[model samples]
Target: MEERYALLLERLTKTEPEFQKAYRDSLDMSWIYHDSALEGSVYTAQELKAAMDPTAPIVTDSSIQPICEEIRRHREALEYIRDFADKKRQPLNIDVVKKIYLILHPEEGDIKTVKYRKDIPQHRLYFHEYAPPDKITYKVRQVLDWVNDPETRRTRSTIRIAARAHYDLLRVFPFASDSGKVARLFMNLLLLRGGYPPAIVHSTERQRYYEALKGSSATMTQIVHESIENNLGSVEKLLEGHESKGYAVKV
Candidate 1:
C-alpha cells in the first residue's frame, strides 16, 4: 500500500498547479459533506456550495442559518488543520486538539477553558465503549504522545499511525460532543503532515466505520488506504483527460 501510494504521489506532484488547486477545491466540499454526514448532519448540495464558496451570495433564509453556520465552521476547521500540516513544524499536542474542537465549536469559548466530559450520558448513542471520565485526559495525552514519538513516526506507515491514532482517541471519547468529528480531523491532520491526502470516511461507509472501530485499527487503515487510492485514481483520470485533449501532461 505504501509503495502504491508513493508512486501515485509522484505522479500527482507533476500535475499543473491550477489543476491541483481545482481538485483540492472539489475535495474540500466532499470532505466537509462526508465529515458532517458522519455526525448525522447532512447538508444539501446548495447549502454546501453556499457554505464553501466565498463568492456565493449571502444566505438569507432564517431556518437554514444554523446549518450553513455549522458547515462553514467545519470548513474552517479543515482549513486550519491543512495550514498546520503545510507548516509541518507544530507537533501534535493537546492544545492543538483543543483548538480544533474550539474551531468546530467556537461558541464554547477559549481553549484554556475547554473541558472533557465529566460523565458519559446513558441515553446518547455511542459506537464503542469510552474511557472513564477520569481516564479521558490521561488517555488523550498518551495517544498524542504515541503519535508524536520519533520512533513511531520513523517506523510506522503514516496510514497505520493515523488509523491507530483515530481509533485510540475515539476509544477514549474525550469530549462530551463532537469527539468523533475531532478524531477524524486529527487523523487527517496527521495524514497531511506526513504528505498524504486526507482520508474521507464517507457517510456511505458509516456502518463499516463504526464496526471497524469496534475491532482493530487495521480495518480503519484499509479504509484510509482505499480512500487515498480512490483519490489518486481520480487525479490520474483527470490528467489522462487533459492528455487526450492534446494538453501537455507531465509523465
Candidate 2:
C-alpha cells in the first residue's frame, strides 16, 4: 500500500500544475459533502454535487436550507484548512487546531473566545463521553505534543497518528460546534502535510465510518488508507486515459 501511494504521489507531480490545482479544488467538494452528510445532511449526494458547480442553475428552496448551509460552511472551512496545511512547516499544535475549529464554525465565536469547552459534552448515539471540561484542554495539548515529538514521529505510523488522532478528537469533543468536522479536518491536515492524500470518510459508508471511530480499531485506519488509495487510484486512472488532455478530476 505504501509503495503504491508513493508511486502515485510521484505521478501527481508530473501532471500539469494547472490540472493539479483544479483536481485538488475538486477534492474540497468531496470532503465537505461527505463530512456534512455524516452529520445527518438530508440532501442527496447528487444534489450536493450539483450545488458545488457554479455553472449549475441555482434554485431557491427554504426547505433544504439546513443541508445547503452546512455544505456552504464546510466547503469554506476545508478550503482554508488546506491552504494553511500546504504552506506550514511547523509541527501541528493547539493553536493550529483551534484555528481550524474556528474556521469550521466561525458563527460560534472568535479565536480566543472559542477555546475548548468549559463544560462536559456527550455523544449519546455513540455512547461516547468526552473528557471532562476540566481535563479537555490538557488532553488536547498532549495529543498535539505527541504529533510533534520526535520520538513519536520516528516510531509511529501515519495510520496510527491519523486514526488515533481522529479517535482522540472525538473523545475530547473540544469545540462547542463542528467538533466532528474539525476532527476530520485536522486528521486530513496531518495526512496532507505528511505528503499523503486526504482520508475522506464517504457518507455512503456512515455506518462503517461511525463504527470504526467507535471501535478505534485497525478497521478505522484501514478505512482511511483505503480512502487515500482510492483517491490516488482515481487520479492514476485519469492520467492513464488523459495524460495529454490535462483532465479535471471530479469528486
Candidate 3:
C-alpha cells in the first residue's frame, strides 16, 4: 500500500502541468455540481452557466468554512482510526464506526427520522431515508460485526465492509448534512489507516460518480475503483506540468 501511494504520487508529479490544468478545470466544474447537489437537484444548463459566471465565486464562505473545519476535525479523527487499525484482534464493530462518523460530523448527533430498509442482508438498511438514532446505532453495530468476523478478513472483504460503511450510512442519510462527504471520508479512512493511501472521489465527475454508486446493490470494488482511478488520474496530471512552488504532499 505504501508503494502504491508512492507510485501514484510519482505518476502525478510527473504529469504536473496537465494534472494541475485538469484539476483547475475540474474544480470549476465541481463548483457547479456542488451547488446543484446542495440544492438536491442536478443543475439546469442555465444554472451551470450561472455557477460559472466570472463574478460569482464557486464556493461561498459558508460552505468553505465547513470544509476547512472538517479537515481540522479530520486530523483528530485520524488518531482514532490509527488506533483502530492497529487493533487487528478486534474487527471494527458498529459502535466504533459511528463514533468515527460522529467525530467527523458532530452536528449530526441530534437528527432523527423514522424510516428504514433491510435490503442489504447483513446491514440494517435505511433505504434512502433518514434513520432514527436507535435504528442507526443498531445497523452500525451489525456492520461492525460483519467486518470484524474472521470469515470476512480478506482484502476484498474489508473493502466490501468499507463500501457498506458508505452506501448504507449515506443512503440512510444518518446525518442531517454532509453525510455523503463524511461517509466517503469514513470508508476511505478505514482503508487508509489500514495502509492504503486513501481513495479520493473528485467532485467534478458526476456521471461517473452516480453511475459508480447507482446499482440497487453497490459494491466496494465499484466505488473504490472509481476513487482510485480518479485519484491516480488527478495526481498524474498534477505532477506533469504544475509548479509545486514548494508545496508537496505531507509524508
Candidate 4:
C-alpha cells in the first residue's frame, strides 16, 4: 500500500498538465459520487457531472429537483473542502469543519451552524446512536484535537489517522444531518494533506461499511485503510496504462 502511494506520487510528478487535471477531476467526482451515496443520494456519476455543470439544461421535474440540488450543494461543498489542500491551510480545525457543515447545507434560511444539534435523530443503521446533543461540542473538539496531536501523528499511519478521525466524528455526530458526509470529507482532508489520494467507500459496501462502524474502531480503521489501499492500487494500474498510451479505465 505504501509502495502504491509512492508510485502515485511519482506518477503525479510525471503527468502532463492535461493528465493532471483529468486525474484531479477523476478523484473529485469519485469522492462526490460515493460520499453522496453514503448520504442517501441516488445520483450516478454521469448525473452528478451533468448537474455540476453551469450550462447543463435544468431538469424541471420537481420530484428530482431535491436530489439535483443535493448534488449541487455537495459539489460545492467538495470544492470548498478541496481548497484546504493548500499547505498553508489548516484542514482539520473546528472552524474548517464548521465551514464544511455550512457548505453541505445551504438552505438553512438565516440559520448559521453555530452549535451542535439538540435533536437525537435515529440512524438507519441498526444499533447506531449519536453523542448526546449537549456533549456534541466537546466530543467533536476531542476528535479534532486528536487529529492534531503530535503523539497521535507520530505513531499512527496516515490511513489509521484518517480512519480514527472518521470513526470518532461519527461517534460524536456533529451536525443534525450530513454527519457522515462531513466525516468522510474530514478523513480525506487528512489524506490529501498527507499526500495520499482520497478514499472511496462505494454504496454497494453500505452494509459492510456500517457494520464496521458498529463493531470496533480498529476494525473500522482497517476497513478504511484497505479501502484506500485498494483504490490506490487501482489508480496505479490506471496510471501505468496511461503511461503506455493504451486505454485504461474508460472512466
RMSD of each: 2.4, 4.0, 8.5, 3.7
Over 1-251, each residue of candidate 1 has an lDDT whose tens digit, in order, gives: 44555766676577778777776778888888888787788888999888777889999998878888888888889999989988877777999889989998887888878889899868654567889999998999999999989899899989899989989988999888899899999998988888787788888988888888888889988988887777767766876786577755576
Q: Candidate 2 lDDT, tens digit per residue, 180-242? A: 778888888888767677888888878887787667557778888878778777777866876
Predictions in order: lDDT:
0.84, 0.74, 0.54, 0.76
* Model 1 lDDT-worst window of ten: 1-10
- How would you encode candidate 3's per-residue C-alpha lDDT over 43-151 as one tens digit per residue? 4443443344445445455745454444445545655665666676665555565566677666646233222232332332222445555576566555556656667
- Which of 3 and 4 is the better model by lDDT? 4
lDDT of 4 by residue, 57-106 (tens): 78776776777777777777777766786564554678877877777776
Q: Is candidate 2 or candidate 4 better by lDDT?
A: 4
User: On a 0 to 1 TM-score scale, where does candidate 4 land against the true structure?
Assistant: 0.85
TM-score of each: 0.89, 0.81, 0.54, 0.85
Query: What is the alpha-carbon lDDT for the whole of candidate 1?
Result: 0.84
Worst 10 residues of 3 by lDDT: 118-127
Clashes of each: 0, 0, 21, 0
Off by over 4 Å in 1: 1-21, 247-251
- Name the regions of candidate 4 deviating beyond 4 angstroms: 1-3, 9-19, 88-91, 109-113, 246-251
- Judge candidate 4 at residue 51 and give its lDDT: 67
Top-TM-score candidate index: 1
TM-score of 2: 0.81
